[model samples]
Structures are given as C-alpha cells and as structure tokens.
Target chain A: MLKFSKSHEWVKEDAAIATIGITDYAQKQLGDIVFIELPQPGAKLQKSEQLGTIESTKTASELYVPLSGEIVEVNSDLVDNPQWINESPYDKGWLVKLKITNHSELNSLMDESTYRELIAKESH
Target chain B: MESRKTPLYQKHLQNKGRIIDFAGWALPLDYGSMLKEAKQVRLNCGLFDASHMGEIEIKGKGAFKFLQKLTPNDISLIAPGQMQYNLFLNTSGGIIDDFMCYYCDESLLCVVNSSNKDKVVSWLRDNKEQGVELIDKSEETALISIQGPSSSRVIARVFGEKIASLDYMFFTKKEIDHRQVLISRSGYTGEDGFEIYIESKDAPYFWDRLIQEGEGFGLISCGLGSRDILRIEAGYPLYGHEINEETNPYEASLGWAVKSNKDFIAKEEIVGIKNKGLKKIRVGFIMDEKALARQGYGLYLGRNKIGEVCSGTFSPNLNKFIGMAYVLSEYAATGKTIEIQIRKKFYKAKIAKYPFVKINTKSKKEV
Candidate 1:
C-alpha cells in the first residue's frame, strides 16, 4: 500500500511494515536539507503524531507520522550525509520503517492521484 | 498595492527565478536550490539583481556638511572615487539603517536597504540644510551586483580590464552602449565583486551580456535566499535583525564605523552608552547539534534566558550550523557554552567569532 498525508509525508507499506519519508515538494520548499533527527527505534507512535525533525538551510520543520505504528528502524547514516534527502528523497532518502499497528489507518490516507490533486491545488 | 517589478523581471522569469514579494517589491527568492547557488558563489561566481536596493544621491555644495550631521561615520574620511560603510542613527542612538556611501562628483551616493528607503528619505528631507538637496534616485536606477571569486573575470569581460583593476572601496565611471554608468568595487556578499549602476531600461541587455560571458566561469543567477546566507556567514547586520530602532551601533559591534570626534544625531547618547556599558552584545555561535536555531529563538545559560538568536543558517562551505545572537555582554565571550531553544528542545551551541567561513574578498593588498 502507498499513501500520503496532508502534511506532505509519504508512506509505503509492505507486509504490515511501512517506510516513510517527506514528499519531494516538502524537500524543495525546505531548500537544502542539512540535519535530521529521528525518533529512536522501538518507540510507539499514533497516526499524525510527532515523528522527528528535518532542518534545512532555510529553516527547521517537524516531521509527522502518517499512520499509527511502532518505529522499527531509522536511516542512521543520514546524520553525516543529510543532503542525501535532497538528492534522492524517495529511495535512499527514506527516513524510517515502522511496524504497522493499525492497518485500517491506511484507508484514511490519500492515494497517489488524490495526493497529486491536493498538492497541485495547494501550490497554486 | 501592487508589488513593484524591477526592469529585469522578464530576465528573472526566463531564468526560472522564483519570485517573492519583498517589502512591496517583486524579487527573486531563488532560481533553484539556494544551497547550490550559494556554493556556486563560494566556488566560482554568481550574478545578482540588486535593483531592489535604494540609492539616495546627496547633491549640492553643502552635501558634505549635511551628511556629517546625518551619519555616525566620519564622512570626511572618504574622497571622490572612494567609499566607506556608514550608518544612519536617530536621536536616541538607535540604528535607522546601515548603508554604503560612495563619494563621487562632490556628492554622496548612499546605497540603503530597500525596506528603509522611505524612512531614510524622509529623515534626510526633515533635516535638510539650506544649501543641500536630496534626490531619491532609486526608481530610475538599476543595481546589478556580480559577486564571488571569479567576479573579476566576468566583470572585466563585460566592461574592460580597467574595471577589474579598480581598487577595493572605489568606483569609476564607464560608458556602456552610450549610456553613462558607474561601477564600484564594493558588495555585501563579503567576496570579490562589482556593483554596476545603469539606466533601468538597459538592465536586461547587460544582464544577458554578463550571463553569456559568465558561462565559462560557472556563474549562476542567485536570489534573496542565498544573499541572506552569505551575509549571515559574513556576520553583516540586516536592518531589522542585528540592527533596529532599539539597537545602538555599539551593541551591534559596529563601533568602528562610528567616529566619536564629530557631532551628529544621537552622538551624545551613543557616547554615554559606550561609557556606561552595554547590556547585550551580538555574538556568533556554532551549534553543537545538527538542529537549527532560528530568529527569536531563546538562548539559555543553564535555566535562565541569556539572549536571542538574530540570524541562523547552515553554512554550505563549513558544513556546520551557525548563527548570530545578541546576548548579555558578560556571557558573550567565545567558547562559552550555551543552549539554543529549538521548539520543545534545547540544543547545545557555543559562542564563536564571525565570518564563520574565512572571507575571500579582495583586501588592500590584493588591490
């Protein structure tokens, strides 16, 4: 399952586990990514809960969890190479993996087309 | 009110510059990737359209005397063809604006912030002496600033080798397309650069010429976003950030520009403030954590609020998070550990000297 949140985070689910990262639009708005701080693994979080922080050359903003889950792993190598998020935000730039706690939560999120329409309107 | 567009608006759009409303003017925020543009300037060169900056020409025989009363700096220090950094202060010793004053044709050309243009013009009018005249030439003039390490080569290609050899802090006249123009060896980016003045109608032509000539030199069109980072890295004061109506020059660490021997607005109050002491002073800091600290964020020593962050950014050249803040003078020493409140958390940072990255501007020796 692939879905996105209104706050511009994208989540990809596979076998009850989901990987997440910020949308390309969010990265562009933030200018250049410099530092990122993610939550430690094994931490439980609810849908739309605070996830971590993403700092850029322009300013700092908070990352949010798209759906309820428990943090299983984080991209630790990002600490020394934060610009990877700016370079390859979708693939290698994935922020963390979370074990799904509520599968139904994905139904409430927007699919690729709906999210695309939302961003198109929002940008204009 | 409609946002005013500069003469080069079409050029900006053609270059894919992201336009933003800045103080009632439409200006470029970035072409793309502020970091890449900033890094390009550090590594090569970048062309900037600074037409939003105001140029107020102080003309007439009494201009020198009028300026002596208007600015904190000793206006007598500069002569024709030379320039000096200056500040405009109010009666309470508050900084009204910081600008570059160039001496030419027995007049002073003060390049001031776009946001403070009206205020500076009104102040000059209200205090005009009998023989002095103030001409606000901002609307008719276009300022194109080419800055960075390779700026000399690019400028020389556009103008002549004579312009490339112009001494730092000096300006000379040139004729481009039969239009009288001015080129100065001065800029705000803390790099080897030139600021060219030409008729507003001729700006687009020159912009294209520079871009064409700058292709081999790796010059990119930069905007306000990179301009902010570069100034912050240089520890230069923005009108409302490091300086304001409440900030005296001494607090902003700009006393070097103030000449105490002369009589000027707020002179007595400024001297008194220096003699008594300053409560807070501006200092630069490096963040120990990768987190960012923004303007208005609190600076703490233990549990007490010691100061406030003025300007903050991630320096591409240094690969470090750096910022400037006004803190209590007692705790302003370099290497002193402090904490910057970034939202709900506090991150460690330490006081450091400015020009966080070594500056590459041409010095007198380079001239």
Candidate 2:
C-alpha cells in the first residue's frame, strides 16, 4: 500500500520494508536536479528528521524523514545521476529503503487522495 | 504592496512560463528546465522580456557633465551611437548601483538595475545640478532582448541585415509598427545579442513578432534563472551579490571602471583604496566536487575562515559547479586552492580567471 507525507515524500510498504521517494509534484516544482546527498545505511532516523538533501541548479532543498525507521539501503546511483529523480520520481528514483521502527507512524501519513488535495490548494 | 506585473504578463502565461516574484516584479523564472534554456543560448537563440528594468533620461546641455559626476567611467570615451558600462559610487567609495548609459548626443539614456530604481532616482535628484532635467521613463519604457549565437540571424530575418549587423554596444532608432523603438547590440550574456526598448503598450506585439520570426532559427523564450547563470558564467558582477553598498570598486576587481584622469564621485577614495590595497579580493572559483558553494558560505584555508561566497551556480558550458567568492587579499590568487564550507564539510575549489566561457560579442571595430 502507498502512503504519503505532507512534505511530498511517498512511501510504499511491503511487509515491514517501506520504499521512499519524493512525489512527482515535488520534482516538478524543483524544475531540475543537479546533485544529491543521501543518508548512509543503518542510520537511525526519527519521524520528521532531515534525511538528505537535493540540489537543483537554482537552490538546495532538504528531504525530511516522514516516519521513524532504520535505513536498510539507499539509492547510491542518484549521487552520479541526480536528474534521474526528476525523470522518474516513483520507480527507479526511490530514495531509501527503511524498516519501519514504529508501525503507528504510518497512520500519520496521508493517502493518495489526501496528498492530491493538499497540493491542489498549494497551487492556488 | 501588490506585486507589479510587466506588460508582457499575459504573453508569459501564453508561453507557459513559470512565474515568480522577483524584486517585487512578477516575472518568469523559467519555462521548464533552466539548464536546457541555458544550453540553448550557447547553441542557438533565446528571447527575454526585460520590461521590468528601469530606464532614465537625462536631458539638457548639463546632461553630459551630470553623467561625468555620477559615474566613474569616462563618458567621453563612447560615441553618440555607443554605450558604456558604468558604476554609481558614493563618496565613501561604495558602489550605490551599476548602470549602463547610451550616449545619444543630445541626451543620455541610462538603464539602472530594477531593484535600485528608487534609490538611484533619489540620488540623482539629491545631486541635481542646474539645467539637467532628470526624467524617470522606467514606467513607460519596456525592454525586450534577443540573446545567443543565432541572435543576428533571427534579427536579420525580421529587422533586416542592416539592423542585424549593428555592431556591439551601438544602437539605432527605428520605426516598428509606426512606433519608435531603440535597438542596441548588447546583452547581459557574453553571447551576441540585442536589447530593444519599446513602449509598454506595444511590448506584446514586439515579443510576438520576434518569437514568430525567431521560430525558424531555433530561438526560444528564456527566463531570469538562465540569465543569472549565463551572466555568472561570463564573470559579470551583479549589483546585490558581487557588488553593493559595502563593497568598493577596487575590492570588487572593478578598478578598470574607475577613470584616473576624470573627476567623478568617490574618485579620491577609490584611488586611495587602490594604492593602499584591499583586505578582501573577489575571485572566481570552480568546484572540484559536485557540491555547490552558495552565497554567504564561508571560505577556508586549513582551519581559518578567509572569506565568503557572493554568487554560485552550476555552469552548463563548463559542466561543473562554479562561483565567485571574496577572500583575504593574501589568499586570493589565480590557481590557488580554497575550501568552501557546505553542510559542515569542506570541499575544495580552484580559483580561476573568468569570462568562464568565450565571449561572443561582435564589436564595432570587428565589423
């Protein structure tokens, strides 16, 4: 099942592992991605903590952890090919694989419909 | 206060430009990818609606002398049809603003940076001598630019060969759609281009004509995002970033703009600063890492902080991250290495000479 955060991060859960990446809406707003800094594997992160940073040609934006978890793996390929995030924010562009530390934290995230409504109001 | 929209506002929407509030003016940041737009300028042509830029007219016989006192550059060096880059320096040797003046023989037309219009106008009036009529025409005038290598070809297709070959820095008055428009062979980008001044009421028509005729030559509309990157790539100093009220001309590596023979504002102070040397010196640097060294970032030599970055960006032409930084005079030298502190980590960068890309401007002498 897919869950989302208000900060534009998306998470797809399978058993206890959740795949995380930014939304297409977020990537579009950023315009272009030039470079990125990802977190190391096995790092313990809490809910709403800064996870990584993405740099566009214009400016840099920090990515925040949507839920508490221990990072299992990160997409290291994005370090050399950051533009891939802009090209595919959902599939190959997945940022980190996290083992959910708190199952109740997933309840705080929004569904697809709720995330769509949030962005729709932001455009106005 | 509400943000002011340029006369080309609707046209920007029609072209699908991503609008942003820049210096209280609603303008296009980019259409989509600023990198793509920047790359296009190097290969072909690009259009820009610069209507938000400020224009001022100095009338009467006192105009020439007023210009002499206002700027550090020698006005007499330029001919009637030519223009020169200039700086408005205060008595303390600080740069109040940077502007360009077109020598019109009868009167001089000055284009000031948009954000500094109010300040520049007040300064001009405060120092107003007799017989000089300082008229601010910024509200009525609109600026449109065609930039890049293919600029001349697109201009030739519409404005004809005579206008296309007008040489760098020179301009001519032409009647377009029964309205008088001023076309100058100049631009912020180092590439060959033309900056056209038209009436605000006629900007849309002017933009449409250029975009339509330019289509055959691969000219696309560009935004301020790419413009900034292009100027920095060419090593041009921006008013707020590389220059400001605190930084003096000599410290900014703009000593060439100051005339030794002519008397102008802050001439004495600038000459003193040049002879006494400066504490800080501005230099351009290319990053050795993928990380960007942004403005206000600290520069380091070993463990000591030496200076700060003023402007930073990724150059599509160079295919690397680059920026301009001000460092201690002792540490500032070409080929010297410095570390930029980003995210609490130090990344190495090499100081290099700029106009990072080869200048493509065609001068009158070259013609």
Best of the candidates, lDDT: 2
Cand. 1: chain B TM-score: 0.98
Candidate 1 scores an iRMS of 1.4
Q: CA lDDT of each candidate?
A: 0.89, 0.90
lDDT of 2 by residue, B1-367 (tens): 7779999999989889999899999999999888888989988989998888899999997999998998899989888998888889888989999988998868999999999999999999999999999989999999999999999988887677999999798998888678878999999989999999999998988899999999988899999989999999988999889999999988898888888899988888888988898999889999999998899999999999999999999888788999898989998889998899997789999988887899988852321
Docking class of 2: medium
Tens-digit per-residue lDDT, A1-124, candidate 2: 6899999999999889989999999998998798888899999999999999998876789999998999999999998788889999998889999999999999999999999999999988
In the range B191-230, model 1's lDDT, one tens digit per residue, is: 8899999889989989999999999999999998898888
In candidate 1 the C-alpha lDDT for residue B259 amounts to 91
> Could you tell me every candidate's TM-score relative to the true structure?
0.97, 0.97
